[model samples]
Target: MRVPIYQVDAFTKRRFAGNPAAVVVLPSFPSDTVMRAVAAENNLAETAFLVQEEGQYHLRWFTPAVEVPLCGHATLATAAVVMERLSPNLGGVVFQTASGELPVARSADGYVLDFPSRPSEKVSSPPDVSKALGIMPTEVYRNQFNYLAVLDDARNVRDLQPDLVAIAGLDRSGIIVTAPGDDGYDFVSRYFAPAKGVPEDPVTGAAHCMLAPYWAERSGRSSFVAYQASRRGGEVVCRLCGDRVELEGSCVFYLEGQADISL
Candidate 1:
């Protein structure tokens, strides 16, 4: 079987600057083992698979290590592929996913993604996590998928050098470390998911789902301009609306090819 595949750099206007996700558009859903193997071979932060069903699309995300319930960058990349490549006439696309229905639409600012807001609950700092991160955060919070670590300075978040092995031992899928931005950005963050085969993600849109609400409650504001402080940095525009969050960013197409897999 030959499947069309694309590589797009999400949350950045330029190639190789943001997180690169492989999008495989298939005629039908393949075996879970095949999807997992493809993701492992791609070896990016995430690989998104799409299958058009009825009138909408069904999407799933896989890391090299495991499948995740929600992934914002991959979803953004998938939307771009569907609207820009597969079907240019489409102005938007709705994806039925593990996290429920996710909608992405084209706008003047780029592709805007509507995602559920994940507000984290305060929790006592885990000593192991603090040790693994090598810097203690002022506060710690946890949602369903990840741990949110709040630091006092952006420099702390940027300069962090954590132990991946120790982080992989944690219970959650990943950890997000964030602080107030120094430049025009409203906030800066870095994500580590050694347990999920992503030691450090370049630009994580999903992390902002939690960060937006956390900062909103503290600053009494509802909108933000966030920058993911990874080696290949990227920008994310965020807004909190009731129970959902809006994340806006652009994508750069990198590679387009076919994956030949024999069954």
Candidate 2:
């Protein structure tokens, strides 16, 4: 079957600037092997699968190498697809995902994704983590993604050049280096997941699930701006509301294609 595919640049208003996510909206669930092959064929960071069921959309994320449990940018990109294509008047979209029920609403500013509060617990980063990076963070914490390294400044986050081989040896999801943003934005961050085949993600939305709340408290602003200082940079509008976080960003449709895959 020729599955309709969409390529979107998430977290940025400009085309070809933000993290790109390939979206495949299938009439029904496709075979695992077929989906993986489709994702691999796309060769993007994450390919989102969307299917409608019981009045809600079922969403799944797949990296170029493997399927992931949760993904933020692609989710936002899916919301954009739904609004722009599936239902222009959806007003809001609900995604029943592995993480749980997630809602994306169209706000005056942009699309707001209400995600669960993923607060990283205060903990010590593994020594091997810093050893691998050749630098230590001022503070460390633990979350679903591994170590959250609080750097001295945004420049440090930008200056990180880790030994990918050593990073792959560590027992962690990935390392997040963050510091206050110099560009009008609240904070700047970069994600490294060599273990997962992505040496450095251009703009990691899931990592910021924790990052939004973490910086919100420190910056003492319920609403703040953020920038992912990756080579293919992106920007995000974040809001902290109690234990939940609202991550907002724009998505640009880059291309449309077809994936012919059969089980």
Candidate 3:
């Protein structure tokens, strides 16, 4: 069958400035192997697939190597695909996912995603961790994903050369290093998920689940803007609540095509 697919640049208006996600709004979910092959072929960090069911959509995310429980930018891309291509006339949509239920609403400004706020716990930085990162961080912590490194400044967040092979061996999924921004943004971050096959995620909304709250308390700012320092930068607006976090960003559809596969 010929399946329709879309390539969206999440968190940026420009085509190549943000994280590229392959969104496939399929009539039905494909097989696990097929989905993995599609993601590998697309060669992006995440590929999102969705099918409507019971007034909500069943959404699944696949990396080239594995399927993740949740993915923020790809979720945003799925919402954009639903708003513009899947069901263009619909007001909004909800996704039933492995991470429970996720909702997406269409706003005049942009899309807002309500996700669980994962507060990190402060911990001593392992000497090897800093050596693997090639920079010494001011502080280190463990979030749900992996180590969270608070650098001296945003410049440090961008300047370090990560030892990806060594990082992959550390444990957990990956690491996120961040610091306060110097310019317009409130904070800057870079994600390294070698276990997930992503050395440096261009824009990681998922990482900010921990970053937003950590910096919010430190900076005395409840709401803040974050930027990923990857070469293709992406923007994120985040709000830290008691136990919930909200992320807002825009997604631009770069291309729409068809996937030919034998079933």
- TM-score to true structure, per model: 0.98, 0.95, 0.96
Instruction: State the weakest 10-residue window (summed lDDT) of model 3.
Output: 254-263
**C-alpha RMSD (angstroms) for model 1:** 0.9
Give the per-residue Cα lDDT of candidate 2 at 55. Answer: 77
As for TM-score, the candidate ahead, 1 or 2, is 1
**For model 1, how does the per-residue alpha-carbon lDDT over 171-217 read when each residue is reduced to its tens digit?**
88889999999788899999999989999999888899999999999
Which prediction has more favorable lDDT, 1 or 2? 1
Q: Tens digits of per-residue lDDT for model 2 on 21-114?
A: 9899988888888888888888888899999977779999888778887888999899999998889988898999988999999977558898
Pick out the ten consecutive residues of candidate 2 with the lowest summed lDDT: 138-147
* Residue 159 alpha-carbon offset, candidate 1, angstroms: 0.9
* TM match of model 2 to true structure: 0.95
Model 2 misplaced regions, further than 4 Å: none
In Å, residue 27's CA in model 3 sits off its true spot by 2.4
lDDT of each: 0.93, 0.85, 0.87
Please give the ranking of all candidate structures by TM-score, highest first, separated by commas.
Answer: 1, 3, 2
TM-score of candidate 1 to 2 decimals: 0.98
